[model samples]
Target: MKETVKTKRRSFKHLVPPVDLTGRIERSTRMDRTIHAVAKAVRRRLGPGRLRDLLHGVPTGKPLHPPLVTVSLGCWVATAVLDLTHADPRAARAVLTTGIATALPAAAAGITDWSSLHREQQRVGFVHAVANLTAVGLYAGSLALRLAGDDRRGRLLSFAALGAAGLGGQLGGHLAYRQAAGANHAESVAHLVPLGWHDLCELKDLPDGRPVARRLGYIDLFVLRVGEGVTVLADGCSHLAGPLHQGRLVSEDGSACVVCPWHGSTFRLSDGTVAHGPATAPQPSFETRIRRDGVLQVRPAPL
Candidate 1:
């Protein structure tokens, strides 16, 4: 029998991410002053509320910016197809205008999400915003030129806009996947936690009316004891894994809530659901029971 050798195909997942530009940008503190000023302004302007939560896609349970961006990019690409095929100039202008118009809401959600990110994420996001804004400006000029009966120049400007938009989109992808910005940082807790009740601590040992951190297998849990009632939730903020144990516990809407110290994402203690975002995903909450031996035990709550 003859032995045959076969070559294995290269897997995309096995390939390393192109992070050179992002690493340099993340390390360079050249724009820290400007980044800080803009970040503060955005946070103040887009503070936690119904309107802000809606923009963060808390209601839809997804980031609105990502999906909204597709509409604008799709229209711009359609315009490019029309221009390249030497199709009617009026059709190209119509699609280009639509892309420009839809960019407003997409930008609104993008900036809102950017406001609650880590400093490093914000640095990359600033550059991403600049590239996108440049694209919008170029597209707007393209529209103006078309209206002025300069189809050739309009097409040229639109092509430039596509380049800028593509650059912005690439940076956005890096943020979403590599940096894990806007991702559910605490999503793995349920998977790692074992079924059945795990011993937490004796009820009397818990600090009264204070939030504290406790270990539950691989997950760190945020435990709060107010009189006889106990609330247990995964200790990581669902946004960026900000320490919920280090957060401020306050009453909002007549319910106890913990505000993430890092990005201010708020979760209601009752069921670990987002009362405010930047965190579209809910924290993993647990059900507790006190054993006959005075031990407090908890298990993952039913979905």
Candidate 2:
């Protein structure tokens, strides 16, 4: 008798293993060369100064991209609703044009922020920007159709554009929530410290004029000793978690500052306030006191 070979049945999961699409995109190495070149170009294009700062929301202590994106997306979505309801063609066209206009500034702010992120974040952000630009192009086509009196076709095209925009928005959400892009990385220090002063080190132990990393609880701190005074702030850079102790000390706007090594985000040494763009949020600072026993102690400064 001939023995039959057994064939194991394969289900969908067996045929195709589950994928972490976002993870894969973030971990991809294939795009590194292009990402570096493009990021450099974007930085060069945007340049440095107030324009970049305004776009980054440095003046307001928040990223302008989010609000600008909200307005642009809101207008586009409103236009689609108007079309479905058979609202006045003028109303539909008006909102569509407004969306197209607002998206320009939004794009500027977004790419400005993207250039300062880590390589992994930049990877996802590049795809996110592409999807958004595609949606904008589709919306432009829809607007042209509407202006040409092809109202029905325009409505259909707008709906398609909305789908593209939705995809882009989903990618953006991934960047914000999962990757923590534009989030203040050093904002958690206040809650982590216990009541009263925590011991850092003895006064004589810290070297003068040099920034050093110290730990308190689970938090890493940037500690600087100059003469008898001690300066302490959260070690994580507000922009991207680059160790502040690893940063270079400089004078910005005639004030003492430390420039983040990873992205050049400047934070004032006096109060941990930001002195440069690409980092809108201030680093959490702490008050220092020397105990009678010569041990340096620190506590969270009053907000």
State each model's CA lDDT, in order. 0.91, 0.90
- lDDT top scorer: 1
lDDT of 2 by residue, 7-87 (tens): 997668765537877788899999889999999998998887889889899999999999999998999999988988999
Could you tell me which 10 consecutive residues in candidate 1 have the lowest summed lDDT?
Answer: 13-22
lDDT of 2 at 173: 93
Q: Which residue pairs in candidate 2 collide?
A: none
Error of 1 at 79 (Å): 1.1
Candidate 2 at residue 247, lDDT? 90
Scanning candidate 2 in windows of ten residues, the lowest lDDT window is 9-18
Clashing pairs in 1: none
Compared with the true structure, the alpha-carbon lDDT of candidate 1 equals 0.91
